[model samples]
Target chain A: MDWIAVADVVAAVLMLCGAFLVLAAGVGVARFPDLLGRMHAATKPQVLGLVLLLTGVGLRVHAWDVAGMLFLVAVFQLLTAPVAAHMVGRAGYRTGKVDTSLLALDELTPDQEAAERAAQDEADGETEQADADPR
Target chain B: MSPATPQDAGWWARWRHRMRTQWHAALWLMVVWVLLWGGVSVANVLAGTLVGFLLISVMALPSIDYRGRVRPVAALRLLGFFVRDLLVASVQVSFQALRFGWTPHGAVVRVPMRDTGDLYLTVTSVLTSLVPGTVIVEAHRITGTLYVHVLDLESSGGADAVRHHIHELEERVLRALASDDELAHAGLGPQGTAVADARAVEAMAGDVDPGAPSVTPEEDRP
Candidate 1:
């Protein structure tokens, strides 16, 4: 095959892969059991798919600077997407929207746990004194 | 001479510190944006910078205390993992799509989260959403519950497996950002067990009934 033809084939393959990835993210959003899982599906593939598609476009355009810029876009996406997800997840947690049954340890707010422990200790002390005094 | 006055001053000081940090983040984002657009034109760069600054200023209210500076290497590692996972999931999902059509058992699951700060959670959510066949529907901020839609609940290797996968993803994020002590205080580490258990329960609830119709019949139809 001529070089141009070969380039076209490669670009086509990359584009296909990118499209498939985007589709996968859509499916993941539809199929994952929870928000977190779905978010995982959405961000990762979207970033990669965009990267792949951009790479294909870059190849077709044959512009080194544009391709390099596209690479930077991918990198910035890699950096920012997680930060956004983290903020959303934390907000969800603090608001008490999370189902506790999904957790094994239930770290319950630290201050609340500490207060409970202190109350229990005081109650125990009072009971011991009452028992000793036999009132 | 008043304690309240000092407290107010302290608060403002903290606020200013946060603002400064945000400004730095804004500057970085502007640079990245400019680079991404691949324009050396002064007008484009100035406009991009202004937009970035405005965004940061508007969203400058400090909520979570993320103490450390950004670590590029850690961020890179997370990106690497995301890329790897995406490729694998893409292949697997494509096969399923081709073979079984689009209708897969779908359910919304609530996943309790460990207290790993806002940043980590945001990253986790975005990463998870990027995976094929999943979507983040709603995140309950108070309860740390993540409501997600999933495909193929029956053949999706059970809820426990899914929970495990999610936990691993979160763990990676925590390791990337927070120190051990910070993680512990955030109710991460061993305390995260509770969150994991809760996820398992939710996953079980999400198990699709085989007899029930799949959600995406149109996509699945050959």
Candidate 2:
């Protein structure tokens, strides 16, 4: 086989694999129960898939000009993806989109539990005063 | 107002500080310019540098406070370990995804990061998130904790495993990038107890004996 033909065959396989990974990510998003879960689906495989697709493109192009640009794309994707995921995950957690029952451990629970206890005690005190005053 | 005037310090000192502040950003911008135009000839490099300086003039970024010296050997070790974890975790996540509609027991595990510098925390969190099965949901700067969402919790041993794995990653990052001062700040100075404990635990875990006890002293205490 010609050298170009070999490169084309490899690139085709990589592109297909990348497509499959992206499909998996889509399925993951649809199937996951919570926002955080979906964010994982949105990030992990998709980034890898993007890398693969870019690699495929670079392989086929085989030109330094385009290859250099492709390298930038890969670097930027890597730098941005995790930061974006971190932001979305933080928002989801703060918004109470995270289901506590499914979570193995939550450090925030301690602070939340303390707040609830304080509120409960105040409510109990108010009820006691109402009962005592016969209002 | 800027603290030091041109006469307040030596000319060389002022120039060096300015160079240090702009060099990284300028170099990165130059690289991007060259890539955008294509080719690595002398003309492209020179033009790219010119454009880079122009961009830097318009947008002055804060200089990075890099405290650590780069240890290439340690960095290579961390990279090797990270790549292995990435592949293994990716495969695991893909397998879990294959089971349609099956939601693995997911949880936000809080790992302590107290006393670690901001740089270490940022580096460790980013590294941890790149692996497929875990994502950092929240990082508490005050409390020094990272709440990581881990997939496929095995009810019995999963949380502990995740915690240990994350700590190991942090240890690796510390070894790879942390300077003496940063390590000391994190209580992992050249001969710190934390690093010692981690190594001891790692050594213990490497045992291949099936008859050996699964629980270590640390696990037993907790």
Candidate 3:
């Protein structure tokens, strides 16, 4: 077979794999009960799937210019995906969408407890700092 | 009149200093410009550079704050580690999804960042989020703690493992990027107490087992 044919086959395989990953992510989001678990479903496969899809496109195109643009797409995705996930997860936590009992461990409780104690102390006129920050 | 001391040292020195501070950003913007246009040529390079300069000048881009020299060797090692984790975690999570009636005993475990600087905090959060099973839910800036939701938590001890794993990742990233002084901090040193901490937390959770049936009868009804 010619090199063009080989490249085409490889690209097809990559595209298929990428599509499968994306599908898996969708299934995960639908099945997961809580918001945090669903966030996991949302992020991991989607980012990797996008990378795979981009790679498949780049291989098929076989042009330096296209490769550069594809690389940029990958870079920007890498840069932004985690931050977006972090935000969504945080919002879920604040809004009480997360079921804490489902988790094996929770470390944020102690911090919240400490904050409550400090607030109690402030109410009792123990501390003079007016602008106490809990976060 | 300009300052008589360093600024007036020479035009060439000033130019070199400017390049040192600005070159990384300039190069990044140029690459972005090329990608946007989908081609590279002399005219594109000139236009990209001009636009980059104009944007940086007009927008007052933040100056680079050099934390430490990034060790390329360590960075490559971290990249390899991250890629490995990505593949492994994705497969693990996908399988978790495929399993019938599988309930994840996930938890929002808090990892301490009291020892790490601000940069380490950012890196740890981003890296953890990128990995499949965990995402940072909250970051307590003053105390330097991160609340991370970990998937597939099997037992109480798993919390410790998760925390230790995050610290291990942090150590790797810090080695790659943190300055000598930051690394020297005693709290940031070594992944020693990870196991011990897990055991301790497990002990603290005497009555409440993670993933045990804590739901009321009404809540339990599917």
Candidate 4:
């Protein structure tokens, strides 16, 4: 077996798999039930897909500099993607974008409702301040 | 500008503290800069370091508690488990989306973390979302609760499984990043009741256990 040819085949497989994952992510986002689930679809497969694609490109490039840059991209993606998802999910939940009724079992709503009740008992100015600030 | 003046003393101290907290980010940016420039030379390294420090200092991040020690063995295991779960869940979710006539059942679970610290809670939350099956809907910092939304019950193995997985994930994170003292404080080591103790303290501090069904309002607030 030609070693170079074997390496090329592996790279090709990685790229194809990466492409497939991105496609799957698109479909999942389109089909998932709620905003949070769609956010999951948007982040989950894309992370692995980006890593795999970067690895494949790095393999084919055969240069340390470009490969290092690709590695950085992967690392940054891994670090930031979930944080972005978390922010989006939190926003979606707060803005009433997430359909709570669609959820089979919701532990969050009860707490949220409870919090709202507690807020109602507070004086008017403090209630407005609580609504404005997450911290 | 001058470090010798009395006014400069506080400024120098503050700058040093900022550097101490921001050195990791600065170093990471410097490495990225050197790599992107392709091939490291003395000039390239110097320039990268200068740019990294300048950028970080100008856009300073809020300081985080950086007291944890990275346990190589536990960190490696956590990485391995994370990657395995990532692969498995991504494949399963991808296929589940592709399958016809099979609607997924989703649920939201509240997992109260053992470790009350923000760093431990953060790492666990990041890992949970990165793994594909669960997305955190809400995270209460004081109470140490993460309200996670699981994509599919069948794929995710139900609410109890999700809770177990979250607790286990938190444990792994605590092992990887938390110091021994912090671990013991979280109730993971030989002597532990920190979670309960922390919750009790928080409850006393006016933070009620809102999500826990078993804990009554009377029990938490008083």
Candidate 5:
């Protein structure tokens, strides 16, 4: 078989796999029962599937620079997807939007709690100290 | 005007601060522009840089603060967990959709937000809505509660399963982001408990119909 034919086959396989992953993510987006669950579907699959699809396109086109650029695009996506998710999640939390029933662990640190308790104790202690020192 | 002296230092400092912030935003924008165009052409580069600079300058004009925040590492971990869950849920959803044909025990579940911020709430809502069968029908900002519709709940599992699943996801997000106090103080935990309680009551009252379809077959088909 010619090299072009081989490349075509490889590209087809990669494209199929990429399509499958994207479809899987779409299924996830549809099937997951909550917002957090849906995010799970959208972010992960879209990132990886798009990368794979772009890679297949690059292979088919056989342009090294185009492939390199596509790789950079993937890298940028990899870097930014989580950041966007973080920003969105933080915004959601601040806005008082969350699904509490789906959570398994609390995210607060002990130091934070201790600090709040200490502040309260200090306030109470100051009140007692003032009462005792009053002439 | 008199020759500048130490009295002018405040103005200099403020100007310096603004410049610093603008430079940072501009640099980020320029990098993004270069990636977007993907060419060494001077015209493309210049145009992109100019656009980036303008956008950054406008954005920096606002006193938007992104400080005193949690680190990004924690958020990455959360993303990892979410991906894993997504894979698992995808399999389950696909199986149910193909084999069982979209008949699910559906319910309107109320989820409480961890007091992280408005950003988190919006992110969570969009994320959840993107999931195939779940949708955010209503959100109570004052109460920090989210009402979501779930698909494909096991009939025998009842509302307890729904409550448990919701709590589990919430806890996962909180732990992933180190947001316990914010969540607890925001009454997310209690709200979850309340959902569990309500589910229990509904179960006892026989109000939950097991035959409800989560998504119709037409909807599940690609």
Candidate 6:
């Protein structure tokens, strides 16, 4: 009975901490200035928060099936959240939501510009070939 | 995953080759299957094996070969660091979120990864993004650069500090994953120090220069 009580106490503490982290994440998304900044707020904290909450559930429930499912959920969240964050971040960058003036330094713009120039050159070469071929 | 034998081989031979080469993936899928059902049973294992094999045959993705040996000690250390970083970043971001009237400034700094493998690049990028303040915005495959968006640019000790931090993480990753030859090729000793103290000093020096330019030296670019 004491063991159960201890587990319950631990679970309650974990759940409380997890709730606070998720609340921080929520506030971050609402308060952050840029699209990219908000993306950080949306994904990162929620990941740890979800893990904590799932762990609390695992301890509170104390069953193998629930534990297994919770483990899978945590692993999947770790794997997928970054990919989702990256997708949103890349898209936000390309769509000009990133707000460059607010940035301390920007290296992606130069790379993007360089890639565009290279693509332009390739297009020009193809155009010249078309002109020459009379196709 | 690479096929152990070419497709021109007979289907039976190919299947056998795949069975040998992709046992790990199958095992992982089996685990996933069992977990999804929230139980481990003989029937679940058999069915999961069948489904995993079937999926492998159906999926024709590009093959990625990892030529690194896993160092258990280094890998565990990396995991420890990752957990510590996760906690540190979580607290910092939470503080930033709760603080009033302070809009955080971020930077998109391209950090060159010394290791040349796609596996290393992908792993490092995923790990970097999983940490709270940093998100991988773009990756240039040819130059092996990751453009990371940092949540607190000044607090991150500026671009150079962030770059060094990622490079250090990448080194830990390579230490965990890369073979000796690969490590040497990346200018890291098996023990994770540089060929000389020069690189370490350079990293240390860069940490002091907050808001440094985003330019890599011409030699480092390629």
Best by lDDT: 6
| Candidates 2 and 3, the one with greater TM-score | 3
Chain A of model 1 scored by TM-score: 0.68
**Candidate 2 lDDT tens digits, B58-100:** 5656555677877788789789887777666665666577787
Q: Could you give the DockQ of candidate 4? A: 0.60
- Give candidate 2 misplaced runs (Cα > 4 Å): A1-6, A112-135, B1-16, B155-157, B184-222
What does candidate 3's lDDT look like per residue over B58-166, in tens digits? 5535454556668788789789889988887877787787776988778877677536656777887888888888888887766667777887776324665566567
Error of 5 at A74 (Å): 7.9
* DockQ per model, Cα: 0.11, 0.31, 0.56, 0.60, 0.05, 0.52
Give the CA lDDT, 0 to 100, for residue B196 in model 6: 32
The regions of model 1 sitting more than 4 angstroms off are A1-12, A19-48, A68-135, B1-19, B41-64, B68-77, B100-102, B186-222
What overall lDDT, based on C-alpha atoms, would model 2 receive against the true structure? Answer: 0.72
Ranking by lDDT: 6, 4, 3, 2, 1, 5
lDDT of 2 at A44: 86
What are the per-residue Cα lDDT tens digits for candidate 4 across B1-222? 233234446766766777876798889888888988988999888999999888877787767766778989888978988898899888887887777677777888888777458888888988998888788878888777788888886567566567767766777788788887887777666223665455334433533333555331212321
True C-alpha contacts between chains kept, each model in order: 0.17, 0.53, 0.69, 0.67, 0.02, 0.83
lDDT tens digits, residue span B86-168, model 5 = 55554454444444234344455545554555555555665554334444555555445555555543432554444444444
- In candidate 5 the C-alpha lDDT for residue B64 amounts to 37
State residue B30's C-alpha deviation in candidate 3, in Å.
1.2
The C-alpha stretches of model 4 lying farther than 4 A from their native spots are A124-135, B1-9, B190-222
Best by DockQ: 4
Using TM-score as the yardstick, the better of models 3 and 5 is 3
Off by over 4 Å in 5: A1-14, A21-52, A55-135, B1-28, B40-47, B58-65, B68-73, B100-102, B130-133, B155-222
Report interface Cα RMSD per prediction: 10.7, 7.7, 1.7, 1.9, 11.5, 5.4
Q: After superposition, how far is residue A104 of candidate 2 from its true place, in Å?
A: 3.8
lDDT of 4: 0.77
Per-model TM-score on C-alpha atoms = 0.57, 0.79, 0.80, 0.84, 0.49, 0.89
What is the full ranking by TM-score, best candidate first?
6, 4, 3, 2, 1, 5
Indicate whether candidate 1 or candidate 3 has the larger DockQ. 3
